[model samples]
Target: MSELIPAQQLRYSAQLLLPEMDERQQQRLFASKVLIIGLGGLGSVVASYLAGAGVGQLLLADDDRVSLSNLPRQLLYSSAEVGLHKVDCAKARLTAQNPEIAISTLPKRLTLAELQVLLPEVDLVLDCTDNASSRLAINQACYTQQVPLISGAATGWQGQLLALKPWLGQGCYQCLYPDWQDSPSCLQSGILGPLVGMVACQQALLALQYLLNIGVIPFGHLRYFDGLQGTSGQLQLQQDPDCPVCALNE
Candidate 1:
């Protein structure tokens, strides 16, 4: 509920010269509160980029700790942090990166009830988390709150990014993964380190664009990238008429 932190002192050269960005858009981004549900590979980059870009406040929720295998991606921590709580370490790194922004770290497991409690205070929600249960909960929260949800997933050499804004006519995450069944994650398939960063960065861009409501167009379609052979493709995603979340009224 606090006022948005001003970005005038922290504006970077890239944002200053961007013809598409103006003071109003920058302020809107600064006023946005983005809730990131993970502290792993994708969540790490998304948090770093958004904080560096001067987002106003952050509601960080992660119930994991740094592990030996997480070294390659989760860049917010050092080797010494192998046993420390992930959200604790991430908060320290992010605050050091830009103390001007407000950060609220919740090092607790989040359920649908918890998400709904936090949903109303934020503008956008980014699901960098790796499970369908969490992603589905986030989708429902966003749809019910009329907040935009930017979702991303990565495994091996494959990556997917989609933004769901039910208030604006786009489909929710459930529209794509309706069954919402639990599936294998990077930990199971071994994701390439860089793939997580790329996917997280795209998620950040989508979140910023949605918050700014600038000239940026919503990616109504789904994007697929094959890091193996450098091949990528996208196919338009039609709104499922019977989607339980995106089209609950029907």
Candidate 2:
């Protein structure tokens, strides 16, 4: 591992102060690479935290453009960037937040083949996309590559997070939701701004822990949050023996 320069030491001083975080851990963070899909509500917060935490390289993928409607939960953009592509706006903001890290932008949706090609170089992936198709695709790719994945979602003052480590021989996102095709979206159910942030923060925290090999990660577990009631819960995810996705891995 490369030694932390004076600049890095100063920049990551807060993290370095943590008992579990020393120069070596800080250096590990600097060496890590993360791919964040969807530059929407969840993705925006996850990207900001990971970049600010000094992740070495960030690959941002999102084909959608910013809009006035995104302003509520997607704090990464402003009114000035409403018409621009989300990845472009996110790249600029993330770069400005931590110029020390490298940001790569993919202003398009990725196909399965494309994800396979990209997953090998990535250490972990964050599935911040709101749709089920995107989530299932991401889950399949990460499982195939044996990469850790952190998936999150929020709607109507509620949020949920799930972490999957394919190599751990646990349940995947597909196993948790076998029939993900006809799920309701934020557009129909509506969502709260802070609800997304809360979920995103948890996703980011789980990613950091997985990357740094710190605390125990709830792999194959679904964590639920109810902002309206100020309560939370968790459920252990079960792998389906009949799951087609899992059969592919076998």
Candidate 3:
């Protein structure tokens, strides 16, 4: 890896100040490649923070277009971009935020085969998508590739975040939701705008910690945030003996 230039060092001075972060870890972040699925509320926050923090390469995938209603929680797009594709809008915003980092986009929803192909190229996967089907597909792809996954969801006053290190025989998203039925989304259930941000921030922190090897990876555990009560809790997740996706790996 190349040494950080004077400008780069100054750009990331805050993160570099941490005892767990140094030139080496900064370089690791700069060399890391992350694939983020979804460009809605959670995806917007996760992409913005990771790009701002200097994650080397980001591959954004989302087929949805920006809607006027999305402006409340999806922070990346402006009113003028209402009709544009989300991945395109996200790419533009993230690039403008950090020109030094490489940003790529797949403007269409990825099929499972496509995800499998892309998984091997990325160091980590962020399942920022809202629906159950997308999340299940992302999990299966990550499990097959043995890549780390940071999954997050927020609806109404509640939010959930989980990090899965599938290679370690840790529980995966499927272990938590065995039935792949469509669940209520923010659109139907009505979401708290700040709740998405809170979950996304946690997801970004987990991704950074995993990439930089800074702290415990939180595998097989879920963090729940209650926006209404202003409290948080953790749930110890266990690998399912019958999890179709991960049981074979274990």
Candidate 4:
């Protein structure tokens, strides 16, 4: 690992102070690469936190352009950026926030094949996409590549997060939502802005923990949040014996 320069040490001084995150762990963060799929509500927060913490490289993928509706939850983009590609706008904002980290942008949605191609280059993947189909595709790619996945979603006043390490014989996103069908999205069902922010922040925290190998990994479990009630719960997940995506790994 490359030594932390004086500026980096000062930038991450608070994190370096944590017993579990010292100079060595800070260096690990600086050397890490993260791929964030979807530059929406969840992706925006995940990208901001990760970039601010000095993740070495960030690959942002999102084909959608910023819209008036996205300004509420997707905090990375401004009103002036409306109609601009989300990845490009996010790249500009995140770059300004942390000029030291390398920021790469994919101004389009990724096919499963593209995800497979990119997964190998990153240490972790964050599924910040809002749709089930996208999440499932991301899970499959992560499982195939044996990369850790931090998945999160929010709809209406609720959200859920799960970390999957299928290579560890754990249940993947598909195992949790087998026989999935199209579900109501934020556009149709409506969403609470803070709710998405909270969930995305949790995803960011889980990503950091997974990357640094600190704390208990939340794999094989789901964390659900209810913004209306302001409460949360956990569900332990089990691998399906017949799960197509993860059974082979087992």
Residues forming the 10-long window of minimal summed lDDT in candidate 3: 165-174
Model 4 weakest lDDT span, ten residues long = 241-250
The pairs that clash in candidate 4 are none
For residues 155-235, write the lDDT of model 3, one tens digit per residue. 989999998876577778888888768768788999977889999999999999988987887788998978999999999
* lDDT, candidate 1, 1-250, per-residue tens: 3433455634554785688776666667777888998989999999999998889898899999899999998889899999999989988999999887898999877989988889998887888787788888888888888777778889888998887666566776777777767767777888888988888988888877777776564556778899888988877667778887777466
Q: How do the candidates rank by lDDT, highest first? A: 3, 2, 4, 1
The alpha-carbon root-mean-square deviation between model 2 and the true structure, to one decimal in Å, is 1.5
lDDT of 4 by residue, 140-228 (tens): 99999989898888998889998888767778888888988777979899997899999999999988988899998778789997899
TM-score of 1: 0.90
Supply the TM-score for candidate 4. 0.96
Clashes (backbone N, CA, C under 3 Å), per candidate, total 0, 0, 0, 0
Q: Give lDDT: candidate 4, residue 211.
A: 80
* Local error of candidate 4 at residue 244 (angstroms): 1.5
**What would the per-residue lDDT of candidate 2 be over residues 36-90, giving only the tens digit for each residue?**
9998999999999999999989999999999999999999999999899999899
As a whole number from 0 to 100, the lDDT of residue 39 in candidate 2 is: 85
TM-score per model over all chains? 0.90, 0.96, 0.96, 0.96
Q: Report how far off residue 154 is in candidate 3 (Å).
A: 0.2
